[model samples]
Target: MAAENRAFVGSIVVAGAILVAGSPFLMGFLQKWESGKARVLVVYADPLAGGLPTVCNGLTRHVTSTPIIVGERWTDEQCDAEERSAVVAVQKRLAPCFKRPPSQMVFDMATSHAWNLGPAATCGSGAMTAWNRGQWTLGCQRIARGDDGTLVWSYTCKTVGGQRQCTFVQGLANRRADEAQTCGEVL
Candidate 1:
């Protein structure tokens, strides 16, 4: 595999030292926004629409070693390990989608999106398309919204009143807006 593809698969040895994929800022961003600290370290039903049994910095079976059981608890060490594992897994899967090295801002924004949505959704998004085309600002705009001003990923299928429907979430909107603002810093 190419050097970039090897990134996030695991720490790479360079100059006799190991380094992760992105800057420390990326990990801090995830740790802060995903979860501040493992208060309980127990799996709980996430409040987001279509949310899964998430624990420890938004970990799910999709990116975990095993299925998450509701009410089950994990140690701080385990939670921390899984958090790193999940982020690296996401970066490994999504790395191939970038035809070129994206700006740090775009990379962070897209990785955050892929962390929430699957890499498949992110790879197929207009933001990814723009990034691959070397349109950083457009990619950031698409991350905030779609091709239009409508929010790109601020809704999810939520069952309410015995009916499943797409529900708009202000938290998600705010998160995307924050991502856009961060992306704008690079412009």
Candidate 2:
């Protein structure tokens, strides 16, 4: 099983290393959002927003064959392998949603959005609708902001005046903006 896992990672590394028409590698670009820790798990939760247990590369689940535990440790290689595997799985799950083939940049951005949000949300998003129509710029813009110009998928629920309301998070907004820039990059 160890040998098989290593072999699988080897293949992913090869595929990940190949440049797609000067586009950034998905894993490397994704690192800007999902940082890696070599020797420990990075677990965090938003006080108001609520979050899940996350490991290397923002992974919440399927980090390993065994279920992940809080405060568990992992090697750099382990983290890298699992991260690549997760990225591949996300890509595959999101593949059928696009009616037209996307450029590498667009595809990577879409995958990044889905990585933060779930695949179900991404599939039903207006961005997905625009992409399905081959409207790349519109889709990219929509990834960060809605038609009303408010940030999307960057909100976390917070209690305001004793009522829970969704509020924008600067960090998540920043990530969305960066993704939008990358997706909007002119080839």
Candidate 3:
């Protein structure tokens, strides 16, 4: 009995020592946002917004104890967490729909688009079909293709107070350009 007790105590000490040795790296990892490097994709997905029922990548489910007000705000940390969750969820949702493996950047780009649209829209999209066929550049074009069925950045213009105003659609032209180039695609 005494021998067994000693062995058990020795095992505990070894285990404790290992934990002590690993604590610094473990703590650093714990302090990091859970998404790791992919969190950058989430940040890119969630645009800065100053409104409640806020749209982050077009996913709007943030709710607090009380009703979310117009000025209900989120810290960078909070927003990161939320966006990371959305990216992960949508990624999982769309994962099985991919016909072929994608590079990490391409997958991140897909996650960004899926966030802006819904998972259903993304998964069932022609973009998904094209990507599944390993037609990456074509898929990317479909992903960024505007409502006019063209790969062009479009904006809505309105006449307010008899003055014409055009709102660039989230600077989407830049996003499309970035994604296309990353995928070695041109439109």
Candidate 4:
């Protein structure tokens, strides 16, 4: 009975060690799977009238808590600073669950463009305009066409932005570029 108890304790210790060591990888795997399925988990760090968006798949998910009042105003510096801070905070929170560091994440900025054009729309035009200036950064698998006309995947990250915001840009390179550019111009 004594020997059996010792063996059980040893097994439990080994299992605990394994769980601790494997936690990061497990979190990364779960995050990748959730992101792949186009589900974004949004975290809001500010209590003011500001927020940002993170892209899941090629779609944008807003992180705001309330409806944006049209005709409101903010300085360009404020907008930029607020946006940068929000994005960095979100990335930091997600970093632990990523296989690599947050710097290596490939976020889709195009999704931010889409959001500004719709839900996060601004009514004013100026340096401190009432714009929804949310930025995005993440690591993602790039999709490209192969010789057989099938999709090929590669891992990469990119910086995408406009006058007021940015987000992770996912999809084929040429197509994403065109769409992002067009959206930026409109914003």
Candidate 5:
């Protein structure tokens, strides 16, 4: 009986080891999740919408347009250059805070998230801690909630009495989801 019990225990241990080794494959990544694909991530967060002044993070300014006067427009080249410059500034602010320096795409996404969400949300919140602790996906998800916690991407709005009343912004939520996904991806 003792011999048989020993064999059974050995078999269980072997099976457990195999399961652990194969866990990553089951989870869809070859290893633990950690992504920083800034370049690709930026594409998802910031799409080209023409050379017009836009409001982001409650600041009405044009990254692509200099002076950002009302009704001012910019060339695609100017916009692209300015956007890149803005990303650089964001990267500089966030890079040092990350426990692991993210890949370019991840960095870009985070920068875009900050740009879209707000500066207070980027480094001065749980997202920063998440990035430092490798729980960045969760951090990014939290970022979607905003500083006041008034929004949730998971919830949408309906037309109430023909008035568009909403507690959530679908686009913003999607952006946050993309950021979180990008952050959790394996580089």
Candidate 6:
């Protein structure tokens, strides 16, 4: 009886391990099967209208052309070039701050906040922190709702045209009168 119990437990463990190992492959196969049932739709420019076709030949699914659009289908090379240009622009904007040997934690936190909010948000009231060592830290923040039904304090930042900037949302509203003011002042 003891030997039979041990064999049953071992078989159950083996079966559980096999099921776990196969789950990812099973899920992928199921997704593929479901996708196979989807219908294919074609879209093309009206030939009588002349010029290049509004839709590209390789599109695998539905297409619409209610709005006027231009530009040829992007090739991988063009896409890579565009991506490289964007990275270069970001690196250029970040160069000055990077030279100060900024902490990775600080940079990441600031960048993440800037990515979410507009660049002016990084400088705002909630996101700004003053360290005891005389350093200023900026990033996301938490705030309470005011009588106006708005959160008055929040840390936020933004990147625009490859330039990074941050500010408190409320402070920005108050300071908008000063046209010459810019977030670049802090960096």
lDDT tens per residue, model 6, 1-187: 1222112111111211211211222212222321223211223442322332332211211122233234434443332233223322332333233223333333333332332233344334243332112242222222122334455434245578999865555543332211112222233
lDDT tens per residue, model 3, 10-88:
1111211211211222212212322343222222223323232442223355321223333445444554445445444
Q: What local lDDT does model 5 show for residue 88?
A: 41
Better of 3 and 5 by lDDT: 3
In model 2, the runs with Cα more than 4 Å from the true position are 1-24, 36-51, 62-65, 158-164
- Reference-based TM-score of each model: 0.80, 0.77, 0.52, 0.27, 0.51, 0.27
Query: Which candidate number would show the highest TM-score if scored against the true structure?
Result: 1
> Which of the predicted structures, 1 or 5, would earn the higher lDDT when compared with the native?
1
User: For each candidate, what is the lDDT?
Assistant: 0.72, 0.68, 0.47, 0.27, 0.43, 0.29
Residue 65 lDDT in candidate 6: 22
Question: Over the stretch 45-71, how does candidate 1's per-residue lDDT look in tens digits?
Answer: 887725578887678888887779889
Error of 5 at 46 (Å): 15
| Model 2's TM-score against the true structure | 0.77
Higher-TM-score candidate of 1 and 5: 1
lDDT of 2 by residue, 75-134 (tens): 666666676667777766776787777777787788888888877788899899998887
Candidate 1 lDDT at 75 equals 79
How do the candidates rank by TM-score, highest first? 1, 2, 3, 5, 4, 6
Extract clashing residue pairs from model 1: none
Q: Over the full model, what C-alpha lDDT does candidate 4 score relative to the true structure?
A: 0.27
lDDT of 2: 0.68
Worst 10 residues of 3 by lDDT: 6-15
Model 4 C-alpha lDDT per residue in residues 89-134, reported as the tens digit of each score: 3333322332321111121221222222322221111100211122
User: Compared with the true structure, what per-residue lDDT tens digits does model 5 show for residues 1-187?
Assistant: 1222112111111211211211112112200111121111111122222333342111225223345544344443443344445544544455555666544444555555565544455667666766667665566556555546644443444568999765644655666666666656754
